[model samples]
Target chain A: MSDNKSLQSSRREFLGKSAVAGAALAAAGSGLVLTRMAEARAPDQPVSNKVRWGLLVDAARCVDGCTDCVTACHEENGIEQSGHAETDPQWMRKVELKDERTGYQLSLPMMCQHCETAPCADVCPTGASFIRADGIALVDRHICIGCRYCMMACPYKARSFEHETVTKQKPHAPRGKGTVEACTMCVHRVDSERLPACVEACAAAGHNAIMFGDLKDPNSEIARKMASEPSRAMRADLKLNPGVRYQGV
Target chain B: MAKMKNLYYRNIEGTSPGYWGLLGALALMIVAGLGAAYYMEHHGHIVTGMSNQVVWGLPHVFAIFLIVAASGALNVASIGTVFGKQPYQPVGRFSALLAMALLIGGLIVLVLDLGRPDRLIVAMTKYNFKSIFAWNIFLYTGFLAIVGFYLWAMMDRMVGKYYKPAGVVAFVWRLILTTGTGSIFGFLVAREAYDAAILAPLFIIMSFAFGLAIFLLLIMGIYGATDRELSDSVLRRWKNLLGVFVAAVLLLVVIYHLYKLYITRTHGIESFILLNGGVYTSLFWIGQILIGALLPLFIIFTKLGHSRFWIAIASVAVIVGGIAQLYVIIIGGQVYPLPLFPGMAASSSFSDGVVAHYAPSLPEFLLGMGGVAIALLAVLFVVKVLDILPESLGDAVLNPPAAS
Candidate 1:
């Protein structure tokens, strides 16, 4: 008698469970439909921007630990030097590199390449991380939940996490923990139609390792330099379409 | 909840106080952990042992170990629910609960280790399909759900009217879960030490060792609480299993390391680091292989099986040793500065320069304490409200048949 009762209860439980599963599936399906509908209704705006910022870095000439560009950019943008520097965003820094083959060494001033198809922005769950209208990948720190998923997603290791709270933070572009940040191509300066701090700094130091301009403008200094010079972006095969390129390391 | 009726408020007479004491201790630790997290959030991850050279430190090691243990804790559940080893069913619910608790603790520790704890959500938001860590997040969450349901079904069978259809689904799911965990460490191509395809199977074995040890301890603790004399056969069975797991883990460690050593190109620095003379050499010998692995192995294989007390001691040693092994695996790899400048020994030395090692800070330790406290408190509250432990009346009277 007890066995018969147990069998009946099991059947009842199974049906109830299957119903819950079916309802969840339906809800998920509807969410997909709603997303597709929204996408269909979106407007097709002009594909071109007036100033599409880009960089051309000359890797061959890059000297090891040359922080000229990094120093200048940090000063201009007022990035904080708090906690572990690597996990915190500095807009620009020099990366010491060593060649595996010939025991050769070089320094690559690393920063956000600002990929055309920025992986960081693409993977953001809340769309809090996005590529701006000005062609720069920036995090809306206000909306950012400080999930460092973007830090791991970037192939270049460009993004940094704010490890601690800061009391002495400069207000030029205030940042806090729990958010992902990286090189913005000096978005604040670009809005004012000024050169990025790193570009200015590199030019000031006479290394000319960096050249910034519009990639679309065929006659622009950046475009001409990029065409004539042997330049490369870090991990180009990633197809991230980086706005920045390396010229001579 | 409906399915968990039998487990509800089922107090194992003698063990209630110990469980409560454990819960109380956990509560205190959780309070400390929360305070630590708040301080760090307001201050920074700089409060921990991590620095630029050693980005991931103690918390990471602990988190990894907890994850491995969580995988291991499924052993009893696997045996009882999947394989239908009726004798092991009593431990299934406890093991599953412990597994879930440990996973939660591990995740908490991992998030605290992050420099940007606030940006932790980014891990979920910015999904890197290629990242093993990312895959682990999804896999772990899924495993928790499966195990949770399986345990619930078992509890229902014990207390409620019937058991849910758990046999095939739970078995298949747990196997995949353990295999998936192995893949997380096994698939890392960035580190040669982890590149061994055998790592997945080895991890599975490690899980068994960790899980079985913890289960035995929990069983003993419960027995103490209920004042029930454990069936001689059950105690013997546990000992036998522990013995087998320890031997297997030890063998795998040997085989895996030896295989790595056999590959000429990979052997030199990596092997020398563990075997010859390096920071890890001492840890490998004293903490992991000797005290943690071999000592526990000998204890279990020898006279320790004669008494529950000795068996418990050996299990604790295994647990401690297992946790230490995780530190060696995660931190050890990072300490060996990537030999990016491979050819010129001079350039490599200068470039790789002796990596400044890391040690966990006060806040990090305290934060870890907080996680443990939460798990303990959770278990305490769960057992309290649900009566997860069976009444000890029969056992208290020293008559097993009377209790039934």
Candidate 2:
């Protein structure tokens, strides 16, 4: 019995050693492949090579009373208004425009200008609101302390407080009270390699006022737009380089 | 094992079963309020009437008021410790404890209102150096801890003297605590109404008024429950202090507003809401300025200050007014919407551009009520445990059960 037990122990040790060695070889192989892929895709390191997203609204193309984009966005997000009865969780909303001097009426859809350096995240007591590595601004409701300090800090009034009791009956995900929530650049969809809801909505509306592509990729549509068109962010002076850009408002 | 065993079985000395029963009811209310808060936490803030437009709601108003009241509650301790006044000593220890409890109660309620109550530690971790609100968190935490130790030391001295220097240090710390609380709102550059440099000093003055009022009520309530009478000298002196502070607060308020109006006609919707715009106008004019500030001033300044009955009534009035004043400071700032969507035109209606508006929903109201209950229960517990009331009052309760 003692000899048989010794033999079994020796066999187990040999098998464990081989398994570890095999894993190490596979890991090394994958590591080299990943490094090569990264080097091939990497852009040249330049001082201003970082993609600073911008928008140029063509005011002439955007007319008054056209909420095609806004409606599409609401439907796509599946936002419901039960208690307060508002598109209060609007990722995009149509705002009436006025002439600087004469108060001329116009309408334009507004959404998150996922800034390069977001003030909302800076003032957040919890790091719930953060600028992603990819340059999209997002609010992680998981860590937010609903102090509303971000609301005061955001100059564009882009964010909204999701106040009101949520219905337990709805096929909705959990969100908490007191924390600030806002546009996430359709990060969940982006993770799944899907286009942002706003981009899809605008395309569906036939206006194609919005575009989404890897700004870093020179071959992407966003890169082409950046090269050809004159676009501006909503508040350029504050120096928050927003991700979303509006064309021909 | 011993402590746990005693916790369930033991009754505090000098209190009856009836008192404990009342405390139990208050405790139950607190539990129910907490349940509601948990419900909101799991569900979403969408349960409340808050919106981006009116992002701040009733909880914020209550929280600010409680914070202000906490500063005010430190008056007795300040007088007894800082100024070396003997008359205020009777209520000093009790007031310090009350201040800590009230501040804690306020903080817990504020935490319940946060969307991510789970990330409360984040408030401590990610400190925004520029924001007054961020600083307020550290200040409030420090204030609570310091005051708690201060009270504990004072109680220790009464029980068995151990540390004299710690007491001295605590006394000095209370001033810094009050100053920090004042700076929380006073240092805000975001809103025009709070931009006045006079706000911190005004906060100190208001603190005295609020502190004195709280001190008086607690003192009187203890005496009532214990059937004791405050010394005539203690009553008269506190009344004088209350009068002086109220007058100063009134004067400073006038100066602050006048200076603000003079500087900018375009202080945005906040100024309009206070001056010519909406319901807040009446709230500011009547509830805060007139009844809360002026009328209470009249009572304290005149012969009514000498009268115990009138003084008590005035303290109650001052407390109510102080609460109203805090609401004006906090909620008033929120009532106005940003003029971002121009030519979209600002909402002239009080509710228009305001993205979010919330009154205390049922749960919120219950939660607030639970806080009040907790405060009451705390005062009740203290009156029973320590010799908080005067020796004369203890003797009265001991000698006669029913006869006042």
TM-score of each: 0.74, 0.76
- After superposition, the stretches of candidate 2 with alpha carbons farther than 4 Å from their true spots are A1-49, A58-60, A72-78, A99-101, A115-117, A133-135, A163-179, A188-196, A203-249, B1-25, B28-32, B118-134, B158-204, B263-271, B341-358, B392-404
The per-model DockQ list reads 0.10, 0.23
The DockQ score of candidate 1 comes to 0.10
Q: What do the candidate models score in CA lDDT, each in turn?
A: 0.66, 0.64
Please write out the lDDT profile of model 2 over residues A1-249, one tens digit for every residue: 889999999989989999999999999999998787564343443223344333334444664666666665555555455545431565566666655577665556676677776767766666677777777777777667777877766656667666654334223223444556566656556544567776676667666666776677777778787778877666464566677655543
Residue ranges of candidate 1 with Cα displaced over 4 Å? A1-55, A63-66, A82-91, A95-106, A112-159, A167-174, A187-194, A213-249, B1-10, B14-22, B111-144, B157-164, B175-202, B247-278, B338-356, B380-404
**Interface root-mean-square deviation, each candidate:** 6.0, 4.5
Model 2 / residue A60 / CA error / Å: 4.1
Model 1 scores a TM of 0.74
CAPRI classification of candidate 1: incorrect
* lDDT per residue (tens digit) for residues B101-181 in model 1: 777887787777554566666657665464455566677788777767766776664633234355346556555666666
Please give the distance, in angstroms, between residue A13's alpha carbon in candidate 1 and its true position after superposition: 95
**Which DockQ value does candidate 2 get?**
0.23
Cα lDDT, model 2, residue B183: 64
